[model samples]
Target: MTSAALSFRYVGDSGMDETMNQQLLIDNGLPNSLAPVLSFKALDETHHVLPDVKVSTVFGSDRGNLVVPYGGSYDILRFSGPGKHDVTDVRVTVQRKTEARNPAGSHDVTTQALDSHGRAIEKFERFSAVRLINEDNFPVFVRIAYILWDQPPKGVTQQAVEVTPIGGLTSVPAHGTAVVKVSGKAAAAVARNSYGPAVSIKAYNSQ
Candidate 1:
């Protein structure tokens, strides 16, 4: 399955020297049918330290596995260090249908970002993409949402932004391909920013 890598960097103005303790939250708008796995890394060893990762359900009953509720939030990463720090790569993988089912069918859905040239860009914190995938014999639907936080110039204060869904609800026909482009915008602007949109795909039997 195709997954998107969210990227971020830290740049401080001159004479700005201080330690930064920050938490990055990712919201999963999809139902429990799709499970999200997040992996983080630092590209430049000298610039930043390896981040601490954690996953928890924001809503719904705890199903043992990391199952974020529909339109629920989860903490993806936490970073604490001094000076300018940059978290290079944050990869997100969505696993379809974690629980076993009778007469198992296709439950695969992935997300990726392409530049204006159609080339895959993995080094970006803010990006947009068109998701294309083939549906199995089972009918399916997709939903997406996003949250953004922009950090201040020096302090740790952050401003929250509202993210709008580019494409509304989408339906996937059985044994057919479906395509949709999703994008988001920050409510307010800040110097250092970190955020991403969440996607959810649910499968249902055709009646």
Candidate 2:
């Protein structure tokens, strides 16, 4: 309902503390029990989003050509409004993760944006990166899953149509990067002064 910030509740491995180890929750007023929250800016015209979504996480290496990690859940946050007038559809591009290198036993994640449908919006060709899994271990390729949902008012139709590539790891065996683009559509049938639901992101790893 027109929140100043947004957050997520991730449910998976990743080795995160159960006590909401997030910035939005700490900065905002989110509780500790519900962890992995993603905080958004403010509510707007395109804010109305749906629930129950999925995202994909692909891990690569900067030196060889792959990335591997233990696993973990990730979340997302927005900082904009949905708008004033009710509309038909809205599209967005997000850049989750960058030219980062991961070490063994630990995890580092980047931020990815989502459309009204909660799909991983891309900003590059392929959301790819490279990192060292362990000190002596070679690089490994990995992939993760993500979920996106719609915000409030309810009874709204939201869908994730496409995921396009924006940027990727060009310099192989040296350093690599990844980027993705996601698009969605929404049917806003009502118009009035009301706040939408809260936006959240959650991620976890497999055993």
Candidate 3:
């Protein structure tokens, strides 16, 4: 922990989860300015990068709190992205099959689509999430958690999915990749972030 480690959440799946009774614990030592991008992978003792066990990154920002469990290093790439900044923490969120969700935190904006002129053209309300589909012959279990918010989507119908997280750089065994769904728009009311975008969009004017 560093000098900036004052604010963080700690609500474990605490008693509801099992103890991995393993050696080599992994701790999050990043400064408050940065957080783990997404979950991580853990391999088996054989040191076989191709085939091994897996452990997920920490749970929600409320839970695990950036610190990982018995396994290798955390996945910094998932937490840090090109366009994403000013994030406290990040985690992979999934729900029951086929239900579009909302952004759990302020950082959970679905990546907006851009036209030739680099303009956003989304109609319905959009939220970002990580979706994983199994395309392999065997069943693969992934460890993931809900978004930063404990509250369910205000008016959407959905259920949570239980996954088995993996540690190490690679996942245990799965034929899939992380497909993110996030979106962001200028908050007209906020003077700092939206002044430029809102002006061009004609949504609001400082004059």
Index of the highest-TM-score prediction: 1
Model 3, residue 176: distance off in Å is 42
Give Cα distance to truth, residue 117, candidate 3, Å. Answer: 58
Instruction: Write the residue-wise lDDT of candidate 1 on 84-151 in tens digits.
Output: 24443333344332321222123543444444455555413444444534445764554333334345
Candidate 1 Cα lDDT to native: 0.35
Q: Candidate 1 vs candidate 2: which has greater lDDT? A: 1
Give the lowest summed-lDDT range of ten residues in model 2.
Answer: 185-194
lDDT of 3 by residue, 1-207 (tens): 112222222122123322111111223333222222233323223423322223333233222233221121222111223322222222232211111111011111122323334445431222133343434433233333221111224332111122112111112123443332322222212223221221111000000
lDDT tens digits, residues 1-207, model 2?
212222223222223432221111112222211112122222224555432222222221111223223232232222222331232222222212222253222233234544445455441212232121222223212232222333324333232122112233222111232323221211111011013222222221111
Give the TM-score of each candidate. 0.31, 0.22, 0.19
User: TM-score-based ranking, best first?
Assistant: 1, 2, 3
After aligning candidate 1 to the native by TM-score, how far in Å is the CA of 98 from where it should be? 21
